[model samples]
Target: MKLLFNLLAFTALIFTTAANADISENSLAPQKEANFAQNYLDRFMQRDFDYVMSLIDTEVAGTISPEKLEEMHGYLPSGKLLSTELIGSQVKVINDNWEGSFTFEYHFEDGWALASAYMIRTEGKISIAGFSVYNTPDSQKELNRFSLSNKPLGHYLVLTMAIIFPVFILVTLVTCIRTPVQKRKWLWILFILFSVGAIKLNWTTGAYHIKLFSFQLFGGGAVSASEHAPLILTAGFPLGAIIFWFKRRSLIGQKKKTQKSQTELKESDNSV
Candidate 1:
């Protein structure tokens, strides 16, 4: 009777261990998905096109070669990533197939852009099958207007504002060193350039948009590719202005000091 009881207890223990093991495996599945998704995103942001391509399925991989992938990567900003958020996800298992949806945020052009991607898992690996920009209807229209309007008045206004404000602030900063007023002016110019450039890029690339306004304005037109010249002019003007302005001020101060010293020496000789 003691042997019979021992055998029953050991059987119960084995069942319990098996149940625990299955539960642990189930819990780990979602975590693995999240980690792999995030790692893939990191590689995308870093422009590691080869690494990203390797994670994708062969059919998708064949459509976009490494060179084409690298070309697309070139268009993306090389700015440091600010943060990432796993906004939401859904996983489905049917028959022997697994599919999932993942939504996440990326810091692009100094602002947050949201993207939703659909992934398919086969053989314990995930690959992105599709992606979409998360933007409202109105925002889409506004972005289209910003990009494709190309109306002479709008173009001139944008270009003029982009150039004139930075130059004015730079000049003011140079003339009034050591004054809080100058510092504030320079800071404002920098802020304006940074924000405007970010918005422009986001609108052009469909990276981010004010949904309600954009859709109303744009209808169904696609987002434009970013214009390299405009972006460069917008960002570079303010930066160059700041640097040159400071250098000019320093040179002017040295010249003034030299003149003052020469006048004092001449006055001393006259006194003698």
Candidate 2:
């Protein structure tokens, strides 16, 4: 009976080990795809053309020569990445090859942008062969609401909110002790306007184009430049303003404290 029990325990152990191995393999599949995507993006951003080419399948590489690839890479600026987030992703197997589709949101010095790329596996390495904008139908609707061609409405709205919002916040915080009532009202109004304008701009400029106009006289570059300007002005300007306000407030507080201490010292001397 003891020998039979030992035999059963050994069988259970074998099954458990096999189950764990299968689970681990399943988990690593998605993680491998995610890492491959990240590596490709990192290399591309660094302008490592040789490394990028090495990852591609020989068939795909034959379609685009090294010279053309280098030229294509030259078009992109060495942008400083502010932040990156993987929004959503999926992977599928097609005839012994794996394909991964991922959406990434990137914030740069210029502005915020979104991208989706398809990575195909060939000979144990993943390569990016195609990409497209990841904007949904709902995103398009929001962009239409901010149509710049229609009138000065979009232009004025963007500019006014960019300037007014930061200025209002800074002024209110600085003068809160002196003009509390007026500051409170302006702060509330500015907060609402800023939120609306930010959402409108985000939808309009889904992602800043890395490759501008290869097709026509208008060129992709033209649209990219045009869209990027407002984004930088709206987001970048406010960020800088906030930093300046904080620094200025710190200085003002220190000065007031120094003056108060000086007054106290003088009063103490008089009493003595």
TM-score for candidate 2: 0.35
Worst 10 residues of 1 by lDDT: 213-222
Q: Pick the candidate with the highest lDDT.
A: 1
**lDDT tens per residue, model 1, 1-272:** 45435534554464344323322222333777766777776676676877777767766766767677666555444466666656456789998799877666555544445556667988876787754443223222243344445344534444454445444443443343433332245553343222222112233433332222221110111222221111211212244345545665555666677778999999999999
Model 2 per-residue lDDT tens digits across residues 103-158: 55555565445556688877886677764332223222133343446444655555
Model 2 steric clash pairs: 212-220, 212-221, 213-219, 213-220, 213-221
Q: What's the true lDDT of residue 191 in model 1?
A: 34
* Model 2 CA deviation exceeding 4 Å by range: 1-29, 74-79, 114-116, 122-125, 131-272
Which run of 10 residues does model 2 get worst, by summed lDDT?
215-224
lDDT of 2 at 191: 34
